[model samples]
Target: MAWQLHYTSARRGPTGRAGFQFVAETPGLPDGVRAGVTPYLSYRPPPDAPPSPDDSELGLFPVSLLYDRVDGRPLLLRCSYLGRDYSGRYGNFFAHAVVAEPDELEGVRPAELWHAPHWTHRPEPETPVLESLDELVPGAALDPEALAAWLSASGPGDPYALLGRLVDAVAGVLGRGHGRVVLVADDVELVARWIAVVSYSLPVAAAARLSFVTYTADPDGAAQRLVGTTPAIWASAQHHASHASAFDLRKGVRDGDASRFARTVAGCWRGPDLAGLDALGELAPLNDPAQEAAAALLALCRGDATVTAAEEGAAAELLSRRGPGIPEWVWRDLVPGVPSMGLDLALALHERARAAGAAEVARQCSLRVTEGVSDALAGASALAEIAAAAGVAGRAGVPVDPAEVSAAAARCARRGGGDLGAALAGCPGGSRDALLDGVVAGLAGARERERAAVLTPGNCDLLYAHAGRLRAVPVIACAVLASVGRRRPGHRIPVTGELLRLDGETGGEVDAALGEVWSEPPSAGECADLLDAHGDAMARRPALAELPSRTFTRLAFPGGDGLTEPAALRLAERVREVMPGGRAGRDAALVRAYGKAITAGPAGAARALADLADADGATPQLAGEAFVGAARRLCPRPPAFRAELLAALSPSARARLGARWTAELPGRARAGRAPLRGAEVGQRNELVEVVLRLRERGVTEPALEAWARAAATRWLAAKQLDVHLARSPRLRASLRDLLGDGPPSRGGR
Candidate 1:
């Protein structure tokens, strides 16, 4: 890797100025037959083509960066210096050279590669000077002749700001028709220049198309290996304008900074134009993390003089996750315990994850967290997705609160009001981008299309809606949503209906989506119907069985329409066919179930009550208004049901009546036609029981009267009867035998 150099004099600005050159066939010029060319400059150049803005005694050198592929071997090293004049004139300082075997190749002359048809230059003022980019704007009146004179007279000033300014200008000037732009950052550090360029010139090129190539390990060794393998590279010298001391590849980056870098590139506007790096053709993201760190640091300083420790940590964490190239400084900041500045770094990680197509878990977690933020508590979701995406999950300590980030984003969404997209775009660094497109579509009523494309039909996807996933997010159905895996004891997995609108047009491709699955939970009977529909089919296809189980237990359809009513009826039948006890058959669970079912309507309630009475499983409590209606319906008489309604009144009702049961009854003799419900036997009146049973059996009123009289007289003859009817119509008719012979008066009792 020895080198031979030749010094060339400036043609215009100054004399005796030295710029070096290396021929491809110099015998020791780092291996070559006609080794294309190398522009890893370590020395200053002519005024017309300076190497860097900070080129003091000597600017930064090229590191021999190259694209492994190219079309021809003209191997051009074109250089130009664009400038403006004090007299308000503009022109370029241009120079070029083609490194070749010489005296052989045709159509290969660097001097002929001018951007425009012709070129021109002007004289300089005696003493030249360098100015800031700020001074360059308004009316860019700095020319190359004056710059060259300035370089020779003042001898190189700090190029940091200068080079940055050039990036803005170059992109605009030479940016047209180029979907892609390449910066031949041969100095390795020049990659920093690329990032700066991306920030300023993003208005010109798409981020996807903006990538660069770099040397791995040894630049010289790598170049040597490519001698016979890949085609020779043709490249230009990088015009890096930074004070040499400003760059140190050993430092690390912060997540905050990385995020800022990304944002700058994504947004652009307001500036000048100048071009040159096109000689670079195309380049990739810097292979070095330092570039990112450097760019981020620069951005940080630009925004604020100081950065927080948390900001550094976040950037470092994001960088470390991306690759092993992060220096120790980036992974952990020198100073710890700094509070977070914002979610920029974390958001950048998400953006990068999305960009690399490596963060489904991260995306989900992010969405889940956001959902949680919207819901005050972020409900039951887990952070597995975030961990997977950021590569810090399960690790000892990585302050990742997907929910917090999401909550902030939700607030941001609300703040924007009418235009969520604008809000998203305006958010500096947040997961809004990850969920933006989906949320926007969701709010626009496109969920159905998205659902069909992403899900399977007839299948609910509550696969992750429980105590640990898909918690209660406020904007769930608002289009933006995320979910997590959930678990419960002895339970079946459920299909959670998605909240956002589907993005795809056809469910044909949806794995197993179902639109109807998201509807409200069915009434008990409806659930039973659903269960029955899947019945044995569930055994063969367990999924069907699972669906019923979810409906019966796990799935909490919104409250209404008499939940589990049908199940109650079904269970009652089951009890009669199974249990033999009396009220024991009307256990607590049965009571609740049947009671709920009775609320459905009068007819259904009457049938259920009749069935219960036959099975001796009826409770004293009438379930609701419907049950009362059912009782009054059949009798037509004021005292409707003949099922001993008063006898079956729940204990609570009896306790509430206290002595009123007797007092109220004795006084109501005139209004003896009791409520449609049957009578109560106050003192173990067997006659009343017989008459009620007979009435229940459809006995006519006369038959009921005969039955009651016969039973009552026999009881009265055998024992001193102490009884009264609680809810019987014409109590005197029922109490005749015991009251007669005395001709009981309807007078004062």
Candidate 2:
């Protein structure tokens, strides 16, 4: 049946005047087919207006249609009231309405008949499916250019580089738009690959938002699940699918629902499977043996095993064909348990081939072994031995070169039980000491017992046990002298003493040797002794003088609460003793010592200093110095101290302290005295007044002001200043400063 729907253009107002009228159409309806219409007002008209008609008889305006004859097509009809209309003739009306056919509706299903206007229109376009990207830009063709560009531009201004922008844009467009755009295969792959890349590479905050979108878009996709299931994302989500879900997964897993986490991992593994493999490989080194073995096996299953069957077979065939004695034990021992057995087997085969007079087989095996053992310790040792033998034959009688000895020792150090050390030890007379020195130098810092064992007498005996060279005679004689002297207590020979006792320039050589062994800065005790016994020498060494004050302070303070008072008193004494010149030097030393003490424990040391300041012979100068030092150490740039110091003095010191102190006082005092109580109002007020006046004059010494404010606040809050400044104008000024200027004209009562 063709239906024509009528719509009112306007409604009745409070005055009871009729408004307007309009018409809408139901799709599949002929041009003149008539259907009754009704007005659905968002709010009802006033009681003075005319009574309304029954809603059932009038029918709903702009309603959807279900046609029994048509398999898929359905129509939507809408009607609205536009203002007052006087005519009822057959006039053309300009109105806004939506008419949709079923197949043309976006996101609409064809099974049932009814339709709505909200559905998006699905356009028929010929474009490649996303999966076709594999064939189009396979493998390396999809390069890192886009990724590098995105990463390079990832800072603030370029939002497109941010994963958040991409995620939000994708979500907004997908959720809001009614039309679809055709994406090229490259674009599809880029999007998919970019999602994978961002899941791993983006910063945590941006990645988190992107991960949410990915999971929300397709919960079943492997890549999405992997990104969602990562420890970082899972922790961020509070271990729940939804905000209301349980955070602890043990309950679910205990109830046999481990599938949730497991399936998430599996999903991640499924999407971009090779990327997953790469991740596994990257994490492999951190895994334990069992995990490594499992990962290696899995890698093998994934077709990335380092050793293959063809390589293994060739090694075995070569060994069988060209061995003097192909030991079955080699196969049973080294080959079976190892992961890269084929490579090791090939090297063994090459060794056998070389001994069996098979030149071609030997050459191939040698090449294979060389490639296989590039980083192996055994290979390095073998290479070093070959180089050393070649070196000795080319230049005989002269001492083996120090560089050759060093190289041979290093190879031996890397692989224990190798005889490089012995070979270097057996150099001809001229080269013996140089070679031994090389071995000792190489072995000096080595942690292994085997490397250090090269220095023992047995190894030295092999090189110089018989007829030692004249140069070697001194070394062997020295060792023998050292050994024999061990039998005597007071008669033991001293290497440095013996060198120094020699005549003429021989003493200079001893001095040089001693200098190499006993380099400077001495030790902490040596520095202390130097200061005690030879202060002049210490004064000459400027670097020693600049040692952190804490180093000396630590010696004075030692440990525990009981030591604080004594430490402070001792430190003051030390400062007086060492820094004897100007007040600036003494003051600097006091500040340094006080800083060390405070860092040792602020409350304890501060209390101790306070106690010391109150002691019997504590002159005001010393007391002031102590207080200033402690104050500076504790709050070096505190505004309250500056303010109080300014306040405690007249305008002269305030002027002297300058604009820095004045400008910083209010802010610093406010911050420093935040923990002080209201009881300190009077003294605090006085301090604040001084600080504000200073600030007005433009002094900004934060350290002095902070100290002054804190001391004054403590004193006044303790009721020490109530009688002194109860009725002062400075107090009023301080209060005004504290409260800030009165609220703006529009604010408060």
Candidate 3:
């Protein structure tokens, strides 16, 4: 009996782009088995063609001949398009012989076989499904028997497993050369089966040896024509449908949720296992406010925390304890976060500190008011807040002792010793004008006796501590002196000069009188003189002078050029013994001075300058100037020495003395004059030679222009006849223009 492959196409609706159905004629042989001996062909004409089934046929010779022997046994026949015909002779005829039960062959009932020789068949047409074996058998398949047998002697178990084993065998054969193996199957299920079987059979070590798998579709005769007509068969095939399954599997692995099979494979490979956080309670205690505040305060002390939540918490706690009053240290911490801390928070802190009776804290808060002033000075937005705080603190009855405050201020000043001169120099007005109000405030409550005592040697420490702030010194000193003088108008505290002039006669008496009110002698000069004298006294004071030499140096000469000759010499001597050579700027200045002095003349001022320069090479400009002055002075008496002076010029000096060379040449030419009987040949020759040399030496443009103009005029007059023989066109034209067409005259001669 003849058999037929009968199955309904899966009813994926008209909206469905493609559909697939597995014809299971046999059961229990595995899901992939299709066993049949019967083979028939049926064709639907191209959708645009006439609706006639007679146009297509399946015939005897190739199909029926193979089927007759294989009857009752299962056979797998792949039917695909051969262009216009379904005859086996026209296209590729693929038939697999196999064994199956009668039930496996039941649905495959025999259809009519066309045995005619008159019909012509077309060559095999291309179909997306049959193009690559991967489409028929996906890489994720479970059964790889047919594929493995095709690739090697090993019968199929799993495609990847067989692939890995085959790879090792090949590697051994070729000593590890690279290659590829392609497996063709009937459908995607077969491919998936291959991959599944191979992957399951092989150990992880073997599985890793297998590298790549590619899938492709196999199309039937119907699919071939329909392919180019709509969306192609490859895109609308079982292989393509299987891609969703493969993609989902791959995505799940990437997202850490692999298929059970893949998980097993991965587990066997012993790859890294990542697990999520389980115990987050270990970091709980850090969230406590008080602890955080204490930590922040500690961090502030260590300079680790700044203007943060922790710092704010600490500030709040400190303000609560000290009322609104906060110490300078707290302010230092708060300053960076000032804007964020808000004006209300700052004011609240200050008021709270004041209420807590913390005077030191209150003082600290008031000091922060100065910070607002500084910010205002810096042009910050918070200046208004700072000004308001300063006003409030000033009126808060804070009883800040000026002396005590001054002492603290003095300490702050000492910390910025180098900055004192700059601060004083840039003071708004003169120091006297600057601190007059502060001085008046300081003197307001003091008695005359107290003021006198305050101005005496006992308070000298305070005055000396702030010596650099000359702005404060004069006003304070005047107030103290005026107060003391007012109290005892007739008091004659013998001055030191008076005592010294008296030769010890009134020394003890003056000392005793001064001690009566702890007063000092009145100076001969008035307040200005006293201030000058006070400055002199401060300068001469041993302790102030005993500061580090660098401090003195900075105070005396802030810039490199500010150093005087003596100072430069002193620094050079000191540095030479201490520092290495090749130090530029100050050090080079000294070296240049020393060199200049060595070359200067003995009778000239250059000698003194040279001596000063050579002593330590200080102030090279001075040495150079002195050398020039001395050269000018000695030039008339010792004219020959002029060459030596010119030779002695530094590169810079050479450039400066450039104009002098031309100026002196004429003087040298006119040195020996003669009666105006004829041109002085020797002098004229000398002038010509000098001019030639000047031109050769690349003299400057202006000097050259002047010299050239003079030479042209003189030449024309001296050699009026030679002017006709002038070789230079420019010179000839100029001479002709100046003298016209004149013969040699007496002046010309």
Alpha-carbon local distance difference test for all models? 0.31, 0.35, 0.32
If scored against the real structure, what TM-score would every candidate get?
0.25, 0.21, 0.20
Ordered by TM-score, highest first, the candidates read: 1, 2, 3
Q: TM-score of model 1 relative to the true fold?
A: 0.25
Q: Please provide, for model 2 over 1-749, each residue's C-alpha lDDT reduced to its tens digit, 9 standing for 90 to 100.
A: 22223333333422345443333333445332222112221122112222332435222211211111122322322222221234432211122222223334322221111122222122111211111001111133223344444444443343222333233333333234321111111112233343444333322222222222111111122211121122233343343343222111111112122211122223223342435433332322221222223233333323444534443444444345435433333323332223444444555544554565656655564444444433332343642443443233223212234465445545554344335444544434454444444444444345567544543445434333322331222333333223333333232223223322334333344334333322332323433343454344323233334321323333333222212355444443443566443442343344444445355453345344444334342233443444444443433434344444444433443343333323323453444444345434443444445555556555544654555444444433324333444566665455345334662122111
Best by lDDT: 2
lDDT of candidate model 2 versus the reference: 0.35
lDDT of 1 by residue, 1-749 (tens): 11222212223233423232221112333244223333332112232333334324223322222222112322323233333222323322222223333222222112112221111122222322212111101111223222233323321242323333334333332324222223322343334333333333332223212222222222222321111011112121113322111112122122222233333332221111112121011111323233334434333423443455454454445454554433323213311211222233434433444444545534543443343233321321322222232232212123335444444333332333233323333433334333333333332333454433332211112213222222233223211222221222112113222322233332221212222332333334544444444333223232232333233232212221222345645634443344324442443233444453335343444345444333333343323322333332332222332234333433333222212222233322213322212333332243344344534544424533443343344433223223344444444443554235643333221
Alpha-carbon RMSD of each model: 24.0, 32.0, 28.6
* Per-residue C-alpha lDDT of model 3 across residues 285-388, encoded as one tens digit per residue: 21222323433432343344244643455545644554333334454454444333432334444565566565665556555544543333234222122223
